[model samples]
Target: MATFVIVGAGLAGAKAAQTLREEGFDGEVVLIGAEEERPYERPPLSKGYLQGRSEREKIFVHPPYWYADQEIDLRLGVTVTGIALDAHEVALDDGSRMSYDKLLITTGASPRTLPGQAYTLRTVADSEALKAGFAAGGRVVIIGAGWIGLESAAAAREAGCEVTVVEPAPTPLHRVLGPELGEVFAHVHRRHGVDLRLGVSAEEVEADGVRLGTGERLPADLVVAGVGAAPNVNLAREAGLEVGDGILTDAALRTSHPDVYAAGDVAESYHPLYGRRLRVEHWANALNGGPAAARSMLGQEVVYDRVPYFYTDQFDLGMEFSGDTRGYDQVVIRGEELEFIAYWLREGRVIAGMNVNVWDVVDDIQRLIRSGGPLPPQD
Candidate 1:
């Protein structure tokens, strides 16, 4: 039987292995992970799990016994040290090597850190620590007003902690939602009693608090740095694969090497619809990309052109975003005050849409984006 070796057993890797078996691959499937825990979904870590709304068992991609019953070799607590592309083998940190007829790399990203002991939410343990700190209900100073920062702020506030969010941008999600819609998020957090210090930087992360660029110090009991995350591409880079913002892959999710494939946060794969390379780091990508890569590995024709999708639940506001924001010059807001459908248009063509406090419209939003047409006039 042909052996398929999968590295970095996150949601993508776990799902890929599951897909292989479901597709009748009957091959020697080995899923390896550096983390001791079995593959689990990460969205809960920053959302429900962190907020104590979700139980720990809900995060796992599969039940603990699923792997053994599926007849898959699941290797936990071991890291893939290196890959010998010429030999089609991967060396493990445990001083063992495994050969594969096909290989899939699903190594995810790591949370960017600050100099001090500021916390970042990426793994289950990280969320557990943050949850405990928030439960204590003291003061929380989060640097960076991105999704993670804002979400954590909401959780902290719900836990009765004094929360302060510092952002260098003019609004919370300026880079993603742009300034206009970004202000809406800022308004929500501010209204919920979050201290939003916009247009400033966290100069220093001290033990007691954070020092602002304008020479202001905010005392805090816990500090969180949600700056961003960088894809773990060192393994792919060292293995002489094409690497840029992430590992370069074709529309079929095949890497530079024929036998190697990449997906999830680490694959900057070509989008047939967008006509460009896109590296999406959202949970939806891992949930879908893994199976796509698995199908492609099985020599099936695949075009991984699914529209990017992600959602957030914070405070009383729940939101879902679909499509890409690239080249969108105009945003049409159909409603206001958290009950709205915001459409991003580029030269009168819809490119992306976000629905806030709205439900069951993602499919329609994605359809409109794929249509690449003007927003339909309401009757």
Candidate 2:
């Protein structure tokens, strides 16, 4: 029987393992992970999990017994130290070696750290720590005005704590949502009593507060760093696989090395829809990429192509988005009030859409994209 070894027990690793079994692969599958806990959803770590509204059990992607029943050897708390490609074996930190006929690297990205007094929200432990700190109730200073920082600020506000978000950019989410939507986000945050600071950089951070570029120190009880993330490509690089911003792969998710594959946040695959190499760090990507990679590995010759989609729920708002926003020509708005939808157009077609508390038309918008129809003019 072929032995398949997969590293990192995150969404990508778990989903890939499940796919292997579902495809009737009667091989010995071993999954290695650095984290002690079972695979859980990471998106919730910054939102519902941080708000204390979600239980630990509710966050698990699958039950604990699921792996055993599927005949998957899940080695939790085991870290991979090295790989010998010539022998097709992986060395573990615990001084054990495992040989594999095929290998999959799904090691996900880690949160970018700050120089001083910085907290991140990438893991469940990180969220637990942040939650405990928020329960104390005081001024919190957050660096970076990206989605993670904004979501953390919203959670802090719900806990009745004063929050201040600092970003060097001219506006929040300007690069991703463009100026108009960025401005709307800034307004919404300010209306919620959040001190949104834009075009200001944090020169230094201390336990007591944060120092701005203007040499002004803002008092803070807790400081969180949500600048962004860097792909975990060290292993792939060490194995002599082509690595750029991430592991470079083809449309079928095969790495430069034959008999080796990668997927999820760690794999930078060719995106047919975007016409370029892209790395996505969303939950949907991990879930979708895993099965696609597995099928490719099984010689099914399937090309991984899907419209990028993700969602975020915060402060009674349900936000859903699809497609890339890099080259959108215009944005069309539908409906009125707080509940509405926004469609981003590119080359006279609906490239992306976002709905905020207006899910009634989500199906319609998806159908329009499937039909390749032009988005309505912005009014």
Candidate 3:
């Protein structure tokens, strides 16, 4: 019997297993995870789950019984010690070998550790620890003002904790949103009573607080580091797979090895739309990439060219961004920060857009990006 083995039962892996069955592939499906708990949604771990608006079990991707009900051979708390590509087998840490006709690696990414009392937001346990740290409304000095850092700051402030956000850039998310739009977000945090510190990094992370490069030492009860994450590509690198920033994959999410594939944060798959390789570590990518790769495994020709999209919720601000914002020559704002639509124009063509507190226009935003049409003249 042909067996399809998927390592790392994160959102991507779990969805791929489900997709395999949905696509009429009746072969054996094995899903493995290093974490003992069942696969769960990660976005809520920092937002709703951390804010007490959601339950721990509510964030799971599927019910505990769903795996068995779907006839998936789910292996929790199992580690893949090695992969024998020639033999088409994966050696487990428990000294067991699983044969595979096709394999998918969705190992995902881990948070980049800084030399500080930092906490990451990738897992349920991590969220719980963050919440416990803010239990007494303690002073929180969080490094990195990216999505994770800002979101954690929001949750911390909601829990009545004093939060001081430190970022090296002039504004938050400067690399992604650029300075103008980034200023919009900076104001949001400042309006919410968060101590916004910009253009400086931590000189030292001590038990009491973080010493800044600007000769200021902020007292902190809990120092959370919401720095960015690096793709977990060590396994693929060790297996001699082609890796650049992340596991290199073709348009169909197939790795260099013929029988092995990669997806999610770990897979820097080719994007036909952008004509470049991208590794998007967002919920939407994992939600869509899994099924796309599953179809490819079943010998279906696919491009896997969905426009990159992601959303973030901080306090009252809800925003959805589409397309890549790099190298845009023009940026037009339709309204002010609170409720507005920002467009990134590359030579008059609308290449990227973000709608803040504007409801139900993501489809329209995507259409604009796909059309590559010039934005209409605005005063």
TM-score of each: 0.98, 0.96, 0.98
Query: What is the Cα-based TM-score of model 2?
Result: 0.96
As a whole number from 0 to 100, the lDDT of residue 85 in candidate 2 is 82
Write the candidate numbers in order of decreasing TM-score.
1, 3, 2
Question: Candidate 3 versus the native: TM-score?
Answer: 0.98
**Cα RMSD, model 2:** 1.7
Which runs of model 2 end up more than 4 angstroms from their true locations? 360-363, 367-379
lDDT of 2 by residue, 4-85 (tens): 9888899988999999999989999998989999888898899888999889899887899999999999999999988788
lDDT of 3 by residue, 292-328 (tens): 8888899999899898999999999999999999889
lDDT of each: 0.94, 0.87, 0.91
Worst 10 residues of 3 by lDDT: 370-379
